[model samples]
Target chain A: MLFSRPMIPIDILVYGIGLAGVAAQAAAGVLEAGRKPFDLFGVVIVALAAALGGGSLRDLLLDRTVFWIADQSYLITALTAGLVTFALVRFVRLPGKLFLLPDAVGLALFTVSGTQAALALGAPWLVASLMGVVTGVFGGIVRDVLCNEVPLVFSGELYATASWAGALLLIAMKASGATPGTSALAAGVLVLVIRLGAMRFGWRLPVFSARL
Target chain B: MLFSRPMIPIDILVYGIGLAGVAAQAAAGVLEAGRKPFDLFGVVIVALAAALGGGSLRDLLLDRTVFWIADQSYLITALTAGLVTFALVRFVRLPGKLFLLPDAVGLALFTVSGTQAALALGAPWLVASLMGVVTGVFGGIVRDVLCNEVPLVFSGELYATASWAGALLLIAMKASGATPGTSALAAGVLVLVIRLGAMRFGWRLPVFSARL
Candidate 1:
């Protein structure tokens, strides 16, 4: 029964990652002209980035098995998402204004995932939190780089801040005796809410030079 | 004595990776421009891909600390390599044939490095070998994509094959009690020899499909 309970959360993470990956890739692919479907290789690359990039970074930093490699589902999911996106691109117009919500969700999940991994490894809190932020954001950074754009991590908006807060909060809640799944859920929700609110409200960070 | 002995090999691996990274970056930066320094960002991106891309993919897949993040020297060396190569591009010209050697060598080292990481993580030998090949070739694939070209990996070359053979050999030797460093060195040499031999002899793989 305990083992079965864990599967519920893991499934949520898996399914969410797959759906978000499809949305992100479809959005990115629309950047391509509809005159041609992205070649299989390119589309899959985008999907993989959108899906696994963040979590992969987190796991590697925390020295844990990458979530995808442990179970083949992530790869198959990304592959399926890429194909479905490519096939359906002609019929859908992605909502440009709300793109950050899924990105935020992925980031939140990855951030918590990274924190959980680091804590499992018995790393210090600072290391755990930092790894979480890195995990949540690194994939998008990579995706942007591969796509020849500057990464979200470097640019404006509350992208990373939202994830960071959720991760830190998850760590705090667990330190105070909260259940793992409940803490993770709360953190994930925080990230999703912050990210969506930021996008919807036009929340912006200060200019690059202002902090100094 | 035991600690120092391990440290000796570790130092060698790090130094070798750094050198190979620099050489690979310089070569890629030049090839990227085909003998010109185009844009600052583009050259740097190519250099980063050449120097760090292989190892990054290896770490991501293996779920290990990214070698670059663990050691900032790799970044410094790559940046320097790209600048120096850009500055000297006007004064030096490499024969087209000579270029293939380092490309193959980079692939070889990357493969061995990846294979080693995978083995250390207790991956199955087959998976380790595949990871090795991925490490050796993925960087160039990334470079080509960023440079807006189809990857050499999917093109008509024995690039991945050389790395794959070298990795399998390394793993076989290691499993039989050969020291890891020695196995790695032999693999690198074998890959280099095979790759260069193919180029020098003008060997090509037979086309798979009858179509153009």
Candidate 2:
């Protein structure tokens, strides 16, 4: 299946979704930074890492021009969101759970995009699925690490699994001759639903207690 | 100043240094993982991250094939080091200071190599210098972050600065028609000496304390 060619004029929709995803990740990054004793520079750096790290890793692994390097819109969006959050953090009192919805949306959207890109690059299905999960979670992992906390995705139930599911669904739809738009949309929605459900249900993975 | 052309038969020397660097970083990764509750898989992954993350990032940014993709020796080295450390952790007791010497050597070797690669790709001296620092410290940053610690390089004094110094020295010597081997050897030694001194002297950058 040709994943690069769009089936319809969904550029605007895709752009909007991508921007929202960036904003969501940036907000989450800023919130994470605020929870620590980060300065303005550190906050901005972490915010950028959270919003862009996954996509950058995907592009790098695929040997493609980094999206932000090619288009300044992503950079501007991420930086703006980060800066605004940093400025308003003192006045804001968001419930911790408020981050879940946007995080799910971002994860879903990035997973679809990452999978499509990997497929277009002729990567194996397994590699594509892994890429999808990497694109969805790497940003959060970097952010958490920078904040000296364990990565939530490592323990968060159904996080990477949701991305893998969405990526597989997209590939399956493509194999069945579905249009790229339909496949991406369906896969993204599946991921979002699963992630939100996990969040709402307080789903968690079983921890392996290391016995030395 | 062609960076790729060898001025002398230093292939064996460079190869040996690179492998030692990889092993050093991998051992450090294993030690860090052992300190945590990481499984074998996590230990291997962290080891790979520490040994290869910097070079991978440099290649990706410069649009070069990832080194490990083109060569398997590095992969084998990192994995073996990690596995060995994991198996022997209970039997071996190491003073934390034991990691510093190997870390310094790895940082120096990687900085010179990263700078040369960037220069060969036609990057400016400043960019190459920054790449050197990135290549030197990026692996440790990944290791620390994955282990849920603040990256030591961020606050560690004279770490990246030493890389920059070495990179600039290499560039200077190259521009003056020095042999690539001479420049690389000298710059690497400078970095190693400076980093070792910093570690021994408890050097650190001033912390930016955010006022609440």
Candidate 3:
């Protein structure tokens, strides 16, 4: 399905968004792993996991050819972005918060794309929506696990919630007969807004500890 | 391939071994997660991840219908094993070392089965062998990740190495025109012996730290 058509304008736009999201997540992965004393290979592994792990899982579940294997661009983009970030960090001390904006954008784009892909494959609504959330947050979860920390998505501000909300909205819009492109755009905007707002205002889900 | 000849003696043996491996891994998962204060649901999630994650990943990479989804018995076995382990642990104080034997068996069975599956699907030798290692270890990695700990396989003993060695052996045997059943049995035995010996003698790979 990915290479059925040559680069039409709409295809270019969608592909561009996907690449940007991958680059953002790869850079974020490098920054997160930087706190640990990992070597370059370790850092690159984290970057690839953060950038591609979620979508790989989604494709696996859907029984599709893995995207990076199908098209080498995504893989190349992640590697280049990771190496650049790794180099930049050594020379210019980057603030931890510097990635938040791009990270939010990546989350939004991934969510929309994942949900749409699932929908196209005729997955049920709940499954499609969950796939969206998975694509948005699972990469970060993997990055944290490699770094030996709790997944930030499990406890961090409104991250997965934002993705889920936007995913559900996308499904709803599609069901209401909206065009695919328009529905995707609206859902992406919603996710970006919610994520950015959450980061700014400390919005969070209730944390609980159950001793049982 | 799994159900083409239902309940033949050989099929029964293979299927039974698969179920036992899943049950063993699920029980191990519950015991590991017991150290954390996760609720029943959380524990169950970890158990399922530990029991099924490896095979699921291998199937996805090989583009096969997921084994559990293709056959519900594996799912039922995993759930039953997890719940039983959870209950048993609450009443009986089990030693951490108690699970090593069954875990070793699981690693052996999963590694052989995964390699065979990949080879059956026409995967190259390297990919098939790696699939075996992935099927042997990825579940434990997922379980540890969910529990917010570094994956034990990464540093503990010769866990992955044993699996990889046996996987390569399996590939070699198959290439030498050994019967699938005999090759699988030999490979499984090799993995079990290596893993148990590693545990008994405390064999280890060199750990390294690089500052760059």
TM-score of chain B of each: 0.83, 0.90, 0.93
B-chain TM-score, candidate 3 = 0.93
Q: How well is candidate 1 docked (DockQ)?
A: 0.10
The top-ranked prediction according to TM-score is 3
What is the clash tally of candidate 2?
A: 0
**Model 3 misplaced stretches (Cα beyond 4 Å):** A1-11, B1-55, B67-141, B150-212
For residue A99, what is the lDDT in candidate 2?
A: 62
TM-score of chain A of 2: 0.91
Candidate 2, residues B89-154, lDDT tens digits: the string is: 656665656667777888898999899999998999999998998898899898887988778778
lDDT of 2 by residue, A36-109 (tens): 87799999999999999999988888776777877677889999998987777678777766666877888999
Segments in model 2 whose C-alpha atoms lie over 4 Å from true places: A1-53, A65-133, A143-148, A155-212, B1-13, B33-48, B60-63, B69-80, B83-87, B90-98, B145-150, B154-158, B193-212
Cα lDDT of model 3 by residue, A72-154, tens digit: 88999999999999999989988888778877888898899889887876665766786798788778878988898866665
**Residue-by-residue lDDT tens digits, candidate 1, A1-212:** 11112222457645666456445543443333222223344444555666667777676666556666564455566656556655554456544444455556666777777788789889998888888888777766766665555665676778888878898899999999999989988998898888888877867777667665
State the fnat of model 3.
Answer: 0.15
* Interface RMSD after interface superposition, each candidate: 9.8, 7.5, 6.6
Clash pairs (backbone) in predicted model 3: none
Residue A90 displacement (Å), model 1: 5.6
Q: Rank by DockQ, highest first.
A: 3, 2, 1
Worst 10 residues of 3 chain A by lDDT: A203-212
Judge the docking of candidate 3 as incorrect, acceptable, medium or high.
Answer: incorrect
Per-candidate local distance difference test: 0.67, 0.81, 0.84
